[model samples]
Structure formats: C-alpha cells, structure tokens
Target: MSSVCSTFISSSALSIKPKCANPSRSRSKLRINCTVGDVFVFSESVIEQKAVSTAEPLLVSAVRGENVERPPVWLMRQAGRYMKSYQIICEKYPSFRERSENVDLVVEISLQPWKVFKPDGVILFSDILTPLSGMNIPFDIVKGKGPVIFNPIKEAADVDKVREFVPKEYVPYVGEALTILRQEVKNEAAVLGFVGAPFTLASYVVEGGSSKHFSKIKRLAFSKPKVLHALLQKFTDSMAKYIQYQADNGAQAVQIFDSWATELSPVDFDEFSLPYLKQIVDTVKQSHPELPLILYASGSGGLLERLPSTGVDVVSLDWTVDMADGRRRLGPSVAVQGNVDPGVLFGSKDFITNRIMDTVRKAGSGKHILNLGHGIVVGTPEENVAHFFEVAKGIRY
Candidate 1:
C-alpha cells in the first residue's frame, strides 16, 4: 500500500484553485506538517494531488463494488448541527433560519463535515424540506415539530395547487451549493445530494409535520388511494427531476431519504410507497445511468425483503436490524450501508469500537458502505466519532 507521512494541517489550510486539467480529474496543492512515517493511502484510481479540495470526486468506486485497501466512510447529516465549525459559521449569520436559507451558507456548512471528517464523501447540507419550501408549501422547522406546514395537502386540489415539479430558479440554491462543493471538495471526496422520497415528503405534507402514528397518511392511502397515488406521482416526477438536476451539475451520487417508509406495513408499502419510489428511481436512472443512487428507509426491518425490487444501487438499513440478517434477506446484488444505532455513539469508546467491529464482521465480504444507521444525534462526543472511524479502519474483510 502507498503511504505518506506528514504533520496534521487544519482543514482551512487547503485552498480551492482554478483547475488547468480536466475538471473531473484536476488536483490542487495542500501543505501539512508531517513526519516520515505519517502515512496516507489513496485509491490508485484517484488522481494524485499536492493539495485536496472539493474538485476531486469523492471515492465512490468502492461503493460501486470496487475493492480498495481502506474502507470509505461518511455520515448521514455530516454537515451542520454536529460540528463546532459549522455552529461557529452559523453564528456569524443572524439565525439558523437565515443561515440554512442562504445557499452560500449551506455550501459552506456542507463542506465543514468534509473538512473535519475527511470522509469518503460529502452529502449536500440542505434538508428534505428544501424542495417543498421552493414549491411554496409554507413550511418551517419548528423546534419539536420537525417540519410544520401552514397548509396541509388534504385533497387532490391541494396537490394540484402546488407546482407538480420544481422550477430551476426556485431551488437554484442547491445547484449553486453543488457547484461550490464540487470545486471545493475536488477529488478528496465525493459529493452526495438527496431528496425526500415521495411517501415521506407526502407524509410531512399530508400529516402537516412529524407523526408517531401516521394515521392521516395511512387513512388517505387506504381510503383515497387515487388521491394518494396522484400526489405520489406528482412528487415522484418532481423528485426525479430534482435528483437529476443534482447529478447534472456535479453530484457523484444521490440518496432518497424515505425516513418514514418504515411506518408502512409491507402490503401498504408495496401499494402506496414502493410504486412512487420505483417511478422516481426509474426516471432518474434513464437520464443518469452511471450515477449511484442510495435509497435509505429508516425503521424498515419488516420490509427488507421488498427492497431489492426498488432498483436502488444501495439500501441503507436502520440500527434495529442486524447487518448480517439484512444482508441475507436483501441478497447479494445490492450494496448494504449502515445499521449502527446512533445511540451507540453515546456509550464508552470500547462499546462503540466493539459494535463497529461486529457490524463490519456481519457485513461479510460483499459490497458494503460504512455509515450510521441513522443520523449522528446532535451533542455526541466528537471523540466517539473519531473512535468509530479508528476501529473501522482496523477491520479486515
């Protein structure tokens, strides 16, 4: 394995500069103090660079089933809320509301995770509600409510009233952020973009926010199947276009966040949720065949059997399920990501290390992507995060 030794440099020490070679393969110089034995091994596939920036593609070939010595790692919601640097940057702005709303701030926060973690990828910093906000849905992030909608979609007309798809300008913020992240990240890591799945987005819009029972959405799905499908279809069309937009600009991969997909019974999921998800995935694939697509469904232990039918390149499991069990059920074709309970991060370093090792062992020898089963809970000790990666780096397939 190739290695480099150097003194650690602060993330800010790296500067993004204009590229003279192919934009996708260009490298920038970064200087760090280091010793003779300090080693860094990059995938032979990555173009060597003197300095790292967002311009280099994140190491996605591993996720696509390519073998490499070091396993790639990145966290869900790696950007914002979790990092002190992100918090400090946000403080410079007036409010969390103002900071998240601004595209430039969003890009800056998104890059913060990359700077700190040096993860294999950078997920875009925007929330799932961004597209809805662009659609003029009148939504806001209430402290406990998650997302509160001023006007919920109760009927077909309400769905019709909202534009069926995102207009380019309304959400140009995402594209702008991607462009900056692409240039800033360079080949050091891959940049990921995401959208809420149709059913999940519909759940927030239909239920008017977060829900424990999802009674309203369930009732609508069963009682007014046509209306639900219509809404789902519209959202599917919009999400497909949204994901494609990200891929077009520079995202190496995209994820569909079906955070609420676990709430449905398998039968209901097949009827109400899977169809629209298939629609979006299929449509997006038509346009960007090579882009990796990850479909993450939280609390989806019961529906693991049905996931393979969805056509997602990767399936992200929640913490409750055993990784080995999920691998067996989902079979060998799909790459498996995550299943470590975020709560585990709050425990002792030994506990976290043991758990991560167990997960790596259970994942067996096939395509596997390392990630938290869910997001990193805010206020987690940063040392725990570091230990998780440290242990993960030591594991062998």
Candidate 2:
C-alpha cells in the first residue's frame, strides 16, 4: 500500500518508484522494490518480504525485517577509545563531558569512526549519563573512576528532586549534532541516537557510579521498591520524549541501552525494568511508528526471551550467547544485532574473518546487523576494527 523507491541492477543507475506490499513469504523469489543504498548490495537472489518505506538507510531496512543483500553493520561503541584519532582528540579535550556535550566535538567524535570505517550506523557520541545533569542529577565521568554521581539518590525525597528532561532546553546540542550528522551521512547510513534505559539510568544515579556487585541499586530495588519505581517512572517519561526529540531532529533510529539491567534476576527485572522499557517503547511507537527502536543489555543470555515483550524492533545480544542460539531464541519477530566478542579483534585477521562469516551464516540472511556484542575494547587494534567492517561489507546473501 506504500510507495517506495528501489534501485535495480540494470545498465545505469535507475531509481524506480514502485508501490509494493509486503509479500507473504519470508523468503520470496520476487525482489523487494525498496531503496537500500550502496551500503546494502543484494545479489540476484530474493529479498525478505517485509513492508519497507521509501529509500531509507540500510540499517533501517535491515532492522525493519526487510530482505537486504547483507545485514547492516555497526558496532555498539564504535566511536570510542580504540581509535588513535579518538585518543588524540582526548589528549586535547581532557574532559569527556566537554567532548560529548559540545556540538562540534560531538559531531567530530561521532564521525571519526564513520570516516575511517564507514559504518552503516553513525551513532551519537553522547553518553547515556549526558542527560542526567539536565534532569537535575549532577554527575561526572572521571578519567579513571568512570561515572560519579554527585549525590546518589536513596529516598523518595531525592527522587522528587529529579527534574523532567527538556532536551531542547538542556541538550539542544544533541539535536544540533544529530541534524548535522544526518546531513553528513545522507542516505548512506543510519544516524543512530541512543539513551540509557530507565532502569540503567536509575542504576547509575542510584548507585552513584558504576558498580561491580551492584548492591546499592539492588538494595534499593529489593527493599525500597516504591522509591525505585518512582525514580524509574521519571526516567521512563523523560527518555521516551528524548527519543522522540532525537527522531524529530533527524535521527534515523534510536537505541535504548539497558546495560545494567542484566544484573537483576528475571523476577526482579520484570518488576523493575520490563514495565519501564515497555512504557518507553509504547510511547515512542505511538508517535514515530516507523522509527526503529533497538534495545541492548550486556550479558543478557538469560534475559533474551523477556526482551521481545518490550516491543522493540531489534534486540542486540552480548557475546555470552551464540549467534545461532540467539537467532533461534529471538525468532523472526525482532531483528538481531551483535554477539561477536570484542576480544576477537585481538585474534588473527583470519580468525576475525572466520568469526564474521560464522556469525553472518548463523544469523541467516535478513534482519541482522553485524556488530560486536559489546563496545570495541579500549585496546582493540584499529586495523582489526577496519578489517571487521571490510569483511562485513563484502558479505552477500
């Protein structure tokens, strides 16, 4: 019922305006008349049968369950410490806050990986905690100690002090940066925007910083469930609006990082994390139904099945789960991204190639995004990261 643009492999560059409904077959002989640019080069074989819109980014198409030649590729933290260029920038701008908050710096840091690797997705360089300060929660990313909350919230009164996020007023730089990124990337890649999930954001503010045992947040969850729920609600509302704001500002897709939610038991996660996540997803979908929403939780092997209930378009896996198992477990309703070990980059180039092939093969043909299970490690070889993208882009269905 929808009109979409598709490129055919004929003599010249032909942009065909075609109206095609989603075919019933998962793998159909008919080629989909949807525009997936140079980043996704499909072979003569059939494409997946999901309804797609007009020429969108390859990552957007892949996540929408549309059949593409190969899965779109982008790492979780593709724009961080691993690159020499990023390190050089860090030397100049010592403060992580300065690097992430300033519009020019955010755009430059975000595009660093895009320039070098030409990733299919150029995610915002801002931190999940970037919005915390705007929400009346003071925090800082210390060089060695990681994130530090000035005053950890432990009670109802502290939760009361948390202000609702006003992205335009507080973080207009985020919107500006995303707008610029979209202009830079054009139709070649998806400009990804991300926010920390309510539970994870709550964890950071509740625990005061990163924690190994996570006892502080768990204590608050187990003992003072009401207080934790109150805080989570505030974050849920704020982040849902934040996603909308990003999408309105030209972010093609937005990912929700629930990095610390895996620490909870299934029962606890259901009570604390699931509802808030679902609320955020439901809220965003109501307004931006076409925007792809991705949810990621590190070490989420145990929580895979529960993830789909949140209604996100994609579920990113950590390395603990096998690609084959993750694909089978998540089924076809949700697209899958990642599960490659970041440490694999340290292995030989042949090993990295084999792993990429193995993951691609296991993920089957459609609805996959080749990525590291987690962020590229601090010491990951830049050449290997380049190799990861090279092998990934060369894959065909």
Please give the CA lDDT of all the candidate structures: 0.74, 0.84
Q: Give the CA lDDT, 0 to 100, for residue 361 in model 1.
A: 60
Measured on C-alpha atoms, candidate 1 has an lDDT of 0.74
* Candidate 1 lDDT, 69-104, residue by residue in tens: 445677887787667887688567745556666888
lDDT of candidate 1 at residue 31, scale 0 to 100? 26
Task: Write out the backbone clash pairs for model 2.
Answer: 48-67
Q: Best candidate, TM-score-wise?
A: 2
Task: Name the TM-score of candidate 2.
Answer: 0.87
How far out, in Å, is residue 281 in model 2?
0.3
- Backbone clash tally for model 1? 23
